[model samples]
Target chain A: MANLSALMLARDLKLLLEERSKAVAYTSSQTHSSLAKGLGILGFHPSQIRKVTCDDSMRIGTALLRSAIEQDKALGKTPFLIVGKAGTTNTSTVDLFIELAAIAREQNLWLHADGAYGASALLCQSRRAILCGIELCDCLSWDAHKWLFQTYGCGMVLVRHRQFLTESFGTTAEYTQDAAETGESLPNFWSYGPELTRPARAMKLWFSFQLLGLNTIDIAINRGFELAETAQSSLEGLKDWEILSPAQMGIILFPFHPHVPAANLDEVNMRISQSAIENNLAATLTTRVRGVLVLRIYSIHPNLSDDEMLAIINGLDQLAHLYLSRASKDDII
Target chain B: MANLSALMLARDLKLLLEERSKAVAYTSSQTHSSLAKGLGILGFHPSQIRKVTCDDSMRIGTALLRSAIEQDKALGKTPFLIVGKAGTTNTSTVDLFIELAAIAREQNLWLHADGAYGASALLCQSRRAILCGIELCDCLSWDAHKWLFQTYGCGMVLVRHRQFLTESFGTTAEYTQDAAETGESLPNFWSYGPELTRPARAMKLWFSFQLLGLNTIDIAINRGFELAETAQSSLEGLKDWEILSPAQMGIILFPFHPHVPAANLDEVNMRISQSAIENNLAATLTTRVRGVLVLRIYSIHPNLSDDEMLAIINGLDQLAHLYLSRASKDDII
Candidate 1:
């Protein structure tokens, strides 16, 4: 259903493709465009979404919100699909869930919280504020794997009401529909969402939950954010490099800068991405910036610390420095 | 997506049209008017779907498959959706998967195996034949919770080619797209099928697997099949009752004696289904032969023996005997 939710977000975001968020807390000047495309898939016309800006960074941060009120005013109920990321994937941004839930309740929208990354913080006393009002929202999607230490594809889409699921996709199969009170009494997963033959993947979460209490998970996740702060401090010495979105969990995005012309930044970044693989580093490279590519180094293991993160940063810097020195040697000729 | 599958099945069954799945999977057998609707969705026409016999169940068994060949000769590779049940929720009928897979390979068809129940028994060496040819098929779906001790929604949809998933519902997302990657590298899960924000429901299966190995699971599922067979044998002992489908898995179907009066039997079975909540027994009531209702019992545990199954059968008989005796008293008056 998160895929469906993302599609709805894409449908709504096409207007200005502005960086709109569902939450009122911590409005940013920039967010990822993936948010824009998420709104476009839900049948929202491009004209329905309008982009507004917050005074954040120019290139890296593009934060704006598509107000649900604008939708409710035009369509009455505004039957929309709203997204509230538990933790934003790119920038580790957390929108105000309580404020968004209030808006969802009053405006009559389908509020689906994308808690894929940050939801595990709910167990954290310090970060409980981040997950505020998740219960009030119509749906909450969190990735147990990203932060909660569940396996990959351990994502969730929890609908507030059982009827919403049944109303959305209930059907009877002659072959499978037992005339007895099979699902008429309870919610069958088949009627709830987009999958029928899905993996019995839920066991990982149940196992982890049983093996380690949520409190332990809470500390571990908080530790990730805690580690991010240390990483930010450690990288401050590197003048050429820039931290884009400081780590929410362990994921910290920073672009490598060479002491070369701006035109070659992209080319060098691509080289560094390949170099990371070639050199057998722990970090894999992904692009969040338009021209500038970033390498994200974050994993679930608590063993990773500031030293490991810095080693990667140092490796990238060394590679860029070498590339720039060769270029300068040619320039001197 | 399973909901859509169910909706298509429902459309084939013709009941509620509240969901998109129902709208998508409706077959021509029941909702004949909507026969061509799916083809149109797949970019085909009404005549594209081969018409099979509605009245003749024998034609549907295998000969209808032969008829599909003529259509295959013309289309080269027909985009077809096959619905097979490892255990049909109603009857527990095991479709011949290997035979269908051979025919599907010959026709180059998209064979979607729907083993929502009985497929859970593939872990059992004795029952493995029921799930044969699964790897060769284009896609397969099954729900683990129905037969296995796993929680609900632990389903699966396996695709043979990763390209099939990337192409069928390929995405055009702003955030997920790479200007450099083209159509080749790093295909996101969103492109693989449907929905964006989802849950780590996979862990549930992992938990079940960990808690109870596949060997245990196999034993449990085959035990359920054994219970169904026991019930069938006992019902066959009763001279009046007529078994409709003595299927392979947990569900048992038998008319309340087609030769005998059915009104009293219908009332008796409905009351039995209604009273099952209070009784706390093993059996439940289900209707399979259209409006005709019957008592269905399933054994979902490996520990459950033939003796226990026979005891439940005796209990159902005692309830029916009491109800029928009361009906006779009314008739005499």
Candidate 2:
């Protein structure tokens, strides 16, 4: 067992020394699994890479790559990334793609951008800037799930150098071959991945992408963004808590004022959202910020309306007033 | 940045400490994302983990937990898991749920199996062993996007520990609502997770699960297992390659025969897998035996029949013969 670990470690070191490391996992600290995997598959130790973030609970993967490249001389290592959405889960933050692409070119690194969540934002005119340099990336990823409103596991990794994926992920066994080593354009994607007999998971994504088309996605993106915008404005300074990050797309993060007592801000935000979710109401929560705790509500569900957003804001206002009153009484005591 | 890493590290340490951690994440090992994430989210440095393998990938996870208990002696710190099946990518590597449940009970750990790939096996009579202890699991995770044939991001996390999830992951805000300390019967899951206004990925999975019931799933599992069994028997006693682990449900791993000239089983298996994938076949490669390097396959599609598996096996057998012939000639020369 020690020998196995040693051999594995040695081979990894050899890859490091030989600099044959071809794939770079570009993940924002925000991305859950997509970015971490690029490096994991390429045989990297977790600490050997960087997962950069932009805001609280978001990652600026593009910026991190640029930083890696800019500091490559000092740090002595180049970075390849499987970049993804910056502030996802809440579908909020996004990385600086244009800058990351430029760094990819300068550093000769493979750039795999993951827009699985926010890339759905590409359909929107306002949010399109967030993905300005996507085409320039060596690879791109997006989820038919999440904002795409498709099935889960409908996440895909699109490599600009499709051949690289073929090189890294593809494989074949002649015994399993339907035919000989002849010249035919057989998809044999089985060779380009690490799994055999893969589920036809792509069909749903393809179906939904075609079914809804760009207009629907764009509208969804716009609506979610609009809701966040309205909620942010309506709830601003209307409470004891403060809003931290404003609505980027369809997310808002703020916390109950930190100086307050063990205020169950987490509990309160949950109640308002629960009031909505349980009654089949429309809303969601993302994460806590500034130790104050926050909520994020963003989506493209037709059920979510402007009125719902307004109600959400009203609920926040009411909660804020109650919290402030409670805090005041606590202060008096 | 150091602080963030420190916090992540601290969180991981707490997960490994003698105290039970919160919001356990149990998934099958075949889902590479879950494999990559086990320690990262738990807040460990990642080194302390040594993956468990059950000759098949199923054992790696169980082994890891056993290692934690026997090696680390952090028995009281219950670990979270996510098992997989229907979307395991490796169809045959369905988790030994009964064994895992036993382990979970013994260690006070939370079991969240990711049956995203192999879960389709649940519908089978012979493969019923895979799902034996499934109901006992604290949580069940599966990707509808895979075999149930949904689209991407169709992953579902089903919790048996309904109350625990609320306690572990519930949150809210006063600015959102105070609820008057009122009676909120059910808590919103948005707070129980790390997302806000999450996409309606649930609808797709819900639709499929409700529509299909278990009968539909059983047929697919039976069919896939048949294909795998056919493929394994056809390739038995091949010249250079041998089945390292034959299919139980759909996953198969075979290493190079010890006497084969391309002795580095990992390298040879990798090369064969790489070549096969480039040809656009329905296959790929992975390293579950870690350093052992074997050709692994997962047959999961209900659309595929046993004959298809035969065609694949024939192709592999031919390749092994060709390789052996070449080696013999080289030795003579």
lDDT of 1 by residue, A1-333 (tens): 454443333223222222222211212333333344333323233344433343342211222344535543465332344455556565656666676666556655555566667677777788777566676765566667677776556766665556665544444554334431364565555555444345666788998888888777777877777777666776678767777767565667776665577777666666666777788864455655444566665554666766886686677677766766776778821
Docking verdict class for candidate 2: incorrect
Q: Which lDDT tens digits does candidate 2 get at residues B286-325?
A: 5544345566666667787677777776676555455556
Residues forming the 10-long window of minimal summed lDDT in candidate 2 chain B: B1-10
A194-225: candidate 2 lDDT, tens digit per residue: 43345576787777668888787677778877
lDDT of each: 0.54, 0.53
TM-score of 2: 0.50
Minimum summed lDDT over a 10-residue window in model 1 chain A is located at A18-27
Off by over 4 Å in 2: A1-34, A37-42, A52-78, A82-91, A179-186, A237-241, A256-283, A290-292, A323-333, B1-333
Query: Residue A40 deviation, candidate 1, in Å?
Result: 8.3
Which lDDT value does model 2 have at A18? 33
Interface RMSD of 1: 8.2
